[model samples]
Target: MEPGVPDDSENLSDSDIRLETVIQQARLAAGIDGQNYRRRFGSTLETDFGSALLRCEEEGLLEAIPGGAGWRPTSRGFRLNNRIGLLLLEHRSSGPDMDRSNAHGMAES
Candidate 1:
């Protein structure tokens, strides 16, 4: 939980990961159209998911084509997802019972 790095649990939920996977699959398989995206995500195109889409676009993770129905993931998004998976794997291997009080105290100096 570095200052700028969001706590993994806070930034991504199970649903968010599932949605990301679905979006990635759609992009790879047949590409996601607005209708398909909405149906798959169980939400509208103008909600929080919509905001996420926009954020992803801004982050260069995805793109929204003018007059197109759905968005597409950029190369960066694909790479980012892979990196995130690796980080999660590392965190899992380290386990969650790690005590950080000593580390925090040292940092205070």
Candidate 2:
């Protein structure tokens, strides 16, 4: 119902959720803007920033600030993002591409 928010009828993929998680991490590290996100990740934005922010909020990983103009990471969000980052790092170091074994149920053999 909110402007820029994605429709709930559409299903978000795993990559979408992953990107949203990382967005929260980026927001915590830099700020909630495309430029900072692209700078931190070294890639152009692949997901809609507003939708990702909404997903993070729905997942309890982020909270809108008092003025509703920005967000801050929740304690749980910090832990979740750190864990995901470490997992991604480990996955990348293990191989050129993530497979079923390394990604922990992400792929099929």
Candidate 3:
């Protein structure tokens, strides 16, 4: 209902949305390589980058590029990305700058 946030009227579960959102943010911030995710967020993450990508693809939120190792967010995914990014920034700004613990928290279920 808020401006700039994705509509949650779709069938996606809250957990699915959250993981896809985190994946999109990670893709934008640290590149799509799974290694980048593990390095930045640690290897014990509940949802790995590859799994998140697969889930997003399954949910029709991301489309794989033809003959390439990359993917492009679908329109839905794009809106979700923008919405999620804004929410994250807003939350971060509302409090102390996010620390590693908070970053790790995002990866948790």
Q: Which candidate ranks first by lDDT, i.e. highest?
A: 1
- What lDDT would candidate 2 get against the real structure? 0.46
Is candidate 1 or 3 superior in lDDT? 1
lDDT against true structure, model 1: 0.48
lDDT of 2 by residue, 57-86 (tens): 566666554423245567776767654344
Evaluate residue 26 in candidate 2 and report its C-alpha lDDT on the 0 to 100 scale: 51
lDDT tens readout by residue for model 1, 1-109: 5898767655786555645654555345234465565566654333324444545566676665444455556778666755433433444345442332122121111
Q: Which tens-of-lDDT digit does each residue in 1-109 have in candidate 3?
A: 8999998757875445544545564445332443333555554222433344445566666655443324456777665665434443454345432232122233332
Estimate the TM-score of every prediction: 0.43, 0.36, 0.33
Clash pairs, candidate 1, are: none
lDDT (CA) per prediction? 0.48, 0.46, 0.46
